[model samples]
Target: MTTAPVILDRAAIDAMIGVIEGRGHRVVGPVVRSGAVVLGDLSSTADLPVGISDEQTPGRYRLTARDDEALFGYVVGPSSAKPFLHATGVPVWQGERTADGSFATRKPEAPTPVAFIGIRPCDLAAIGIQDKVFLNGYRDGVYGDRREGVFSVVVNCVEPGGTCFCTSMGTGPRASKGYDIAVTEVIDDEEHWFLAEPGSDAGQEVLAQLGAAPASDDERVRVENLLVDAADRMGRGLDTEGLPEAIKASMESPRWDEIAKRCMACANCTLVCPTCFCATVEDETDLAGLEAQRVRRWDSCFNEEFSYIHGGSLRPSTYARYRQWLTHKLSTWVDQFGEMGCVGCGRCITWCPVGIDITVEAAALAAAAKEATHV
Candidate 1:
């Protein structure tokens, strides 16, 4: 069902703030921090990152002022939505032993309901890919409990990043689904407003409270054009047509060795990746040896210990580990899940300590496969 689109002025957004605040939920969105746009808790419209834009590259990030006061001034940051849902340093298990050797256990606290505003379309797509691993495959109760209370208000990308390739991944520039409400900002000398569409009943209720006017056909056309323009500005892309087969064929290719020499094995790629889901559990005790707890943290296949088995590690060499990571992300992930593991957000490209690009790697493999086929 399609609800009529609405044009929301800045004043109308303030009204939305009241609606959310009245419902006893905190609002979090993008704000300027250390010369970059970051997702954080915000109280008012003034707290948003206005007149700012971010420039991201491997091992470098900077924020610049924009001519217009656009709320979503940047593409994405190093952090994704994962930290909000599955918290770091979470106490998975807490217990105390009795004198009789019996033990008492305490459950972890649940995450509070959060209303997230200004989420980008590609990020929303990344959340969907994450759900495939957390909710679909394993049905993680911790992630599920936190995700259930999330209310998302997605914002379309007005400016794509230099490493962004969401268009090639069929993810975004425009958010088609997975959000309660989708907003496209329209800014110019004369007009500064948002064209919003509600995808859920909660979103419709929020829109109704905002009292925004219905958008004109011309305004809708303009928003669509903005999305198209963002897509056209993409600076990176991957050809996924034969990616799985191509990656499988290139297992013995020399490209892996070249990359391994450059890779630092710092696991920054996995940390920044929106869909890399490997994790490890740890148990710890206090110094006095009175109490103990178990925790789970994010783990990466790049770690040398990740492939450890009974006798020896399966991926003993850096070349093998790098190959495993690239293959799992672009190739075997499709076989394991019905969809590609990556959303083309380019976080891996930006956060790699040595600036190793997955797109370039894919291109090299594709070219190598073509040459081998010709021979």
Candidate 2:
């Protein structure tokens, strides 16, 4: 069953918010705070980043005010909806002393329903990658349950940031799927509105509650032009043809040494990445020693302890850790999950203290290999 594409004017924003909240779901969207566009719990359309946009490049991010008040005027932020769906720190279970001194364990409570608005396309692609890791085969119950109740509303990128390479990754300028609803905003000197299409039953139900009209022909054309302009403005791209094989072949390359020289092994890249799902568990006990709890926290391969097993660690050097992080993300991840782990959102580039661009490194390795073959 298909719901007609609709025009969502500024007024429709309130209606949409109302419908989602009325259903007892927490609505999360992009909001400007502490000099960045970040995901925050929304009470109304006023919370969105109005008259604001962001500028991003490798190791750089700044917010700039726009002439117009377009709701989703910014590109992606440091974090995505990933942290919400896949928790960074989750209580696994609590244990108490039993009558016989054995521990009795109880898991944490289930997640409540959540509605996401203002999610971008590259992040949507990353969410798809995470779905493969946490939801397939031997599943992660916490991440799976958190993801199941999400009412996702995707916003197509009208202005991709400088570091963004979703075009090269074939993951963006627009989100084609994986959301309950998708929206594209078209703003001009005179008017601003969103062209929306429903992608699921929940999306259709929300639309039915809003009483929005079918999108006009002029509005549809505006959206087409909007996306085309966005594609033109995208600054970076990765050459992914033969990428997995090329990355594997570059294991012996000198690029890893170069990366290690600049990389501090701080793990900021993995922490900010939407698709990186490495986690570590810890058990804590009180002074009385009668109760204990096991908790899960997001972990990174950059940590020295991550590769530790038995007598020593597998990735002992900074270079080896960097190599594993990049190789697994771009190469072995395809083998493991049948999809590339990176969606070209470029968070690893911007958030890194030294600003290492993955696309640049991947292309350098491939080009070096091609030149060697020619020689």
Q: CA RMSD for every model?
A: 1.6, 1.2
User: Which pairs clash in model 2?
Assistant: none
| 312-370 per-residue lDDT for model 2 (tens digits) | 99999999999999999889999998878899898999888788988899899888867
The models' CA-based lDDT, in order, is: 0.83, 0.87
* Candidate 2 structure, TM-score to reference: 0.97
lDDT of 1 by residue, 38-69 (tens): 67887877898878787877666678788987
Which ranges in model 2 have alpha carbons more than 4 Å from their true place?
none
Best by TM-score: 2
Task: Report residue 69 deviation for candidate 1 (angstroms).
Answer: 1.3
Q: Which stretches of candidate 1 lie over 4 Å from their true place?
A: none
